[model samples]
Target chain A: MVQLGRRYGTGPSSLAEIALDEDLPRAYLEQLVTSLRDAGLVVSTRGAHGGYELGAPPSEIRMSDVLRALEGPIAPMICATDDPAHLLGCDRSARCTVNVLWVRVRDAISGTLDSMTLADLVPARNITLDPRDPTASPAGVA
Target chain B: MVQLGRRYGTGPSSLAEIALDEDLPRAYLEQLVTSLRDAGLVVSTRGAHGGYELGAPPSEIRMSDVLRALEGPIAPMICATDDPAHLLGCDRSARCTVNVLWVRVRDAISGTLDSMTLADLVPARNITLDPRDPTASPAGVA
Candidate 1:
């Protein structure tokens, strides 16, 4: 996804190119792109010179939706899910006072995922780092 | 942890009792308790009424430490672990701009986990929740 985000608007790149650039197996990319395409996160153009591109601009693609498309739903436990419709039954629900904690965890994960887009991960842009970002390591600076 | 938290001041709970209360297999709890005990998250007793208890008060036990003890370091990707000591090798480390996003995610998860303790999950006591907690649902009101 990050590879595709970087190549956005530059024209579709073949899986072989992405695989080589990202050091991932082309076979894995083949399987992954299918899911991403099915989820409308990527668009495939078929032909001799055609391949895959981001379905939308990087900035418009929320990581939450991309993750849900790839991984189903973000859940810390079977009893707690971000999706209201897909919550699994837990025998402890009736007496599980800790369910709220798992729910809070799920919400936190969902909120973080929602706050990011593919553009945030694509290195091609001059991203202004948030001063409060703990991930903004001094190592990342020249 | 929640089970032990609930029984904090009540001495100890036999694995059988806790297995029944949480609907978990006693054998799994047996193994899990050993790991928690080694992490100083739980203490064990031996005798007819012996079982496990929290090593410290519930409020003193951070979920982040508990999770780290149980699950090792938190990382959204192999290259972006929360702990600096245990970063996994990644072929793309040199150009993995997406690594920072995973670090942000780890930080978010750690922050949320650290903000909570077993006390927050133990319903035996009153907890004044923040108004901004999205997981504080109306269903939890009654």
Candidate 2:
């Protein structure tokens, strides 16, 4: 998604190019791109010069959205799912004590992913260093 | 583990009692208890009065430790696993861009779980509220 977002408006990039560049399987990319297209995260063009591009701007696409498109909602456990449909089926939902912990975990993950955008992950962007790491250096500094 | 921790130092709680109280299957509990016993998280006694108890205090056992003992290391993906045995087999470990994202997610989850001890999950310790909803009440509060 980030790659598609980066190359957005430039031209459609083929799955072949993306798979080779990303070192991922072309077949996996085909399946994943189908999901992305269905989720409206990526738009596909069919022609000799056509391929795939982000459905929207890089800044408009959040990691959470991309993750959800690929893997469904960010559920650590089925019982901890945010979707009401999933929650309806858990027999122990009313009395499960540990479900709270799983929910918190799911939220923490969702929170982190939602906080990041495709723009933030784009290559050549500013490096984010850990403030607690005294030995850490900036991206380009020697 | 929570049940064992809750029953810590009181007396050995039988697998049957724990399974019944937790609404889990007895056979599943047996297998899980075996893992817990092997992991040294719980100690078992022999004979008719035999049962299990936490090897340590509730506060001494973190959720991260319990999860690791039960589910193995918390890897969001095989490529993101902290276990060297798993990492050694990943051919794309060197150049996978998204491995960084998975590692961050694993770290976030580990940080949350590691920060919490079994004591934290014990009912009636503290009320956890949903930060997103100002109107949200604590778990039991009206």
Instruction: Calculate DockQ per candidate and list them.
Output: 0.57, 0.43
lDDT of 1 by residue, A44-128 (tens): 9998889999999999999999998888879988889877788887866888786777788888888889999998887754433
True contacts kept of 1: 0.77
Q: Which candidate tops TM-score?
A: 1
In order of appearance, the predictions have TM-scores of: 0.82, 0.80
**Tens digit of per-residue lDDT, candidate 1, span B39-142:** 99998899998988999998999988888888888877778788888887777678778776777778888888899987787775434378677765522344
Residue B62 lDDT (model 2): 85
- Predicted model 2 interface RMSD: 1.5
Model 2 per-residue lDDT tens digits across residues B1-142: 8788667778888888998999899899999888888988899998797999999988898888888888997898888786767674477655445676777888889888988888877765333466565754534465
Error of 1 at B77 (Å): 2.6
